[model samples]
Target: MTVQLRHLFALATCALLLGGCASNPPATARYDFGPLPAPSTSSQIGTLIVADITGPTALDTEHMQYRLLYADARQARPYAYNQWAATPFQLLGQRLRANFAQAGVKVLSTTDAITSPTVLRMEVNEFTQSFDTAKSSQGILNVRASLFRNHRLLDQRTFQRSVAAPTPDAAGGAQALAEASDALAADLLAWLASVPQP
Candidate 1:
């Protein structure tokens, strides 16, 4: 081919390559529990050890999961372009610790120094955003909370929180889930107050 023809072929090949790259999917969106209140320095109660949260294998992933109750309620689906910064189990634990600390309750991790302290352990039963209709949805969090003292179970109960989504999409689901987590934390704190302490 002539030089002019060869140059045109090279330009077309470069254009095609660039177009292919442009067609790639959008960047993934990562989310977290959002901003937190300043941690309190006062300790109304003794140091409390928060054990690592436990949950099903699915909850152990960073995927932002949801359920189409109006369609297939039994199947959980993950967002294609959105994800949590960490697993739901880890995010719940962090949120709980933050909330407790902000409430003037001393919070410690399981890895921290051990004492005959009050302990809080949680197991997530279900965590997902459920769409009841094409335009309505809510975030649902169900967990089993157990309080321990001196390695003895002081009290145990299950808590469930559901918060409506402002929108019917992933962004709304994340916000709803965050609010539901806060609600769950508040409930746990109230329950601890009413339970008989050792």
Candidate 2:
């Protein structure tokens, strides 16, 4: 073949290779939380009084990016951002209410219902996020909770759960966080059920 034709062929091959690399898209990750189990029949029937959740509170901030190192010594890089619906205090309150309701307990608001037989209050101790790099992901949530009754301490507990994206994307990270929150809710409910009734 002529040198001119050979040169043209080489340039075409290089362009094709570069084009393929540029068109490649990152993998997408998704998460689906299975349905939660119902409360056990052994839970007690009582008036559930939920007081205002006092904080030092923690909230799901807008999603951000972080670096990840794969197991193969390859750098996966970072991309995308995410966020959550409620703060830690808000999440705890909602979960407590839902779980108690499922147990057939009546809920009493402090403003409208003052005649409740018992009052439940909670204090948040810790809520923070940490990152994981080996899994090509960004964060984990840790929390500590305390329970009270009529201004007296009833029980205090700590909870920790890992939240990570299935893929390095904002939506996936958000989904992981939400799933972690739901798991926290379930754990809190189980603890509440075990509390002695007044």
Candidate 3:
């Protein structure tokens, strides 16, 4: 082959490689709940330990999920190129601890030496964005919250919060989920206050 023809072939190959890289950009977009409120120091409540949140197999991973209400209301989908920095279950525990601490409620972990302190156990039943239309979606957060004191169950409640997405994309769902999380934290604190302490 001629030198000019060989150079042309090399350029073509390079162009194809570059185009492939462009089309298949790395799936590196990572989202997480932002900074939490500072711990409060005034009128303190007794310590509460947060247990690891449990959930179904689908939600056990870091994949960000959504339901397609427009196509199939029962089907859930994970974004191909988007993901949470951590699983929802794990994030929930972290956020709850932060929220409780900020409300002047001493937050403890399972690793603490205390044996009978109040415990907050949560089962995440549903956590996903559901798209009703191509242009709109809502973040749905559902959890069964149970409080234990002195090794006895004190109170249990199911909390559900849905927040409208500003857009129909994963970013919108993430923002909505964050808002719903804040709402859930507030609701849980109120419920805990009303429950009889051990």
Candidate 4:
């Protein structure tokens, strides 16, 4: 073959190989919940108001950058292969409401009737996910919460736990986050149930 023809043939082969690599599917992540534990029983159905989680505050500075995955400056990251999801504040609020409902607590919106004497307000201080090098790109989720009623402090707690992604890929990281969120919700419910009603 002439030099120019040989060069063209080599270029075509490289293009095909690169295209195949680009189209390859990301690895799948697995999530497992061991059991569905019963919700805590409450004798009185109290009005629990879940305010929209407030923050992206200075408290969040520590974790703000952690959620972003490393990427090349020129190449934008792929959302389909990225672990980005609802903000932590939104996720925590949703999970909290679900847990309260499962525990037989009556959740009230801000405008709901105030027949119930007590109100529960929560402030989230920390919600972060980061890669753990020891576990080969596995990630960890950490959350902190505080509770109040009628502008007086009721309770405060911090929750931190690590979850392992199925692989080093983004899908695996997302799965790990879901697992962590579920576990946190369950724990939060249990804690709330244990608290004595005023």
Candidate 5:
């Protein structure tokens, strides 16, 4: 074949190979929260209802999120093949309820006929794996919490925590996030206990 024809044939082969690789779906990995600190049955501070936590629509799914602080700090991205076993809100709510029980708080469901005297509502503002630089990353968790009694607002506060990842990959991020989540839950329960009951 002529030299020009040979070059064209080589380019076509490369494109075909690359296209095939690109077409293959990447492997997906799922993650979830670690075992919670066990439930508490001894203390009954008061019956409290934990309303479903709300957050940005983007976080309403099971996708794993990360922020590129070194590039555009405001931009959040999801891993193409990595996802949470459950959505962040669901996981957070589950952990928080478990923590409250462990703390001797009587947690109840809103639909129960005998309603709790107090209600805890929360909204998650930030939940992601943030990278300060290419070599470092951490799981960040921020939440806005509100307390209510007899349908009246009592207090509101925001909590934020960050835990460093053991590695810069999804597994590391998952571990860091679980730690941060547990920490946040503990803080919330402490804050609730400090609030005076009417």
Candidate 6:
């Protein structure tokens, strides 16, 4: 075959291979908090509404993020073949609602159309799986919480948790993140109990 014809053939073959690969991407894995633990038998803390969680625009999506602290702690990267079943906030909210209800707290939604003197709000500051070394990683979650009465601030605090990953891959990161999120919820619940409700 002529040199030019051979080159053209090679380019066509390369394009076909690339197109096939693009069309058949690897299966993506989705993660979420698996299940609720044993319910709390405590009585209701009284009527309280949980406002929708707010955070930086980055946390508004279904991306499962991680950071390499040993490399560039400032940069967060997404898993190519792993993701959350929903936005991080959505999942966290579900867990919080369930936990509060299980604890016998008369949990109310922001849209419940009911009057309540107490409301809980959260602003997620950071949520990512951070790797300190090639084989060492932890899921870090940081959030600022505010308790309000009559739309005025009643109390506020920042909560943070870091759970070690069982392994070094995305699966491990996901598990660690789930644990960290649960820890945050526990902390928030305890704090609520301490606040002077109106």
Q: Which pairs clash in model 1?
A: none
Using all chains and alpha carbons, the TM-scores for the candidates as numbered come to 0.87, 0.55, 0.87, 0.59, 0.84, 0.86
Question: Candidate 4 lDDT, tens digit per residue, 1-198?
Answer: 999999999999999999999989885333222233466544244667766666645432212223433443222223343333355566556666776777677887567776554555556543434544533544455556666666676787877656777866555655665567667766666666667777
Best by lDDT: 1
Worst 10 residues of 2 by lDDT: 57-66
lDDT per model vs. reference? 0.89, 0.57, 0.85, 0.57, 0.87, 0.87
lDDT of 5 by residue, 89-135 (tens): 99988888887777777787676665677888999999999999877
lDDT value, residue 170 of candidate 4: 55
Candidate 5 local lDDT, residue 113: 62
What is the Å distance of residue 16 in model 5 from its true position?
9.8
lDDT by residue for model 1 (1-198), tens: 999999999999999999999999899999898987454333346568999999899889999999999889999999999999999999999998998888877789988888647889999999999999989999999999999898889889999999999999989998999999888877887887787655
Kindly report which residue pairs in candidate 2 clash with one another: 63-82
Model 1 misplacement above 4 A: 1-23, 37-43
RMSD of each: 3.1, 7.7, 2.8, 6.8, 3.9, 3.5
- Candidate 2 structure lDDT: 0.57
* lDDT tens readout by residue for model 2, 30-66: 3223243565543554676777666541233322324
Candidate 3 vs candidate 4: the TM-score winner is: 3
lDDT of 3 at 148: 86
Q: Residues 1-198, candidate 3, lDDT per residue (tens digit)?
A: 999999999999999999998898666677777877454333245778888899898899989999989899888899988899999998888887788777887787888887547888999999999998988899999999988887888889999999999988888998888878878988888888788665
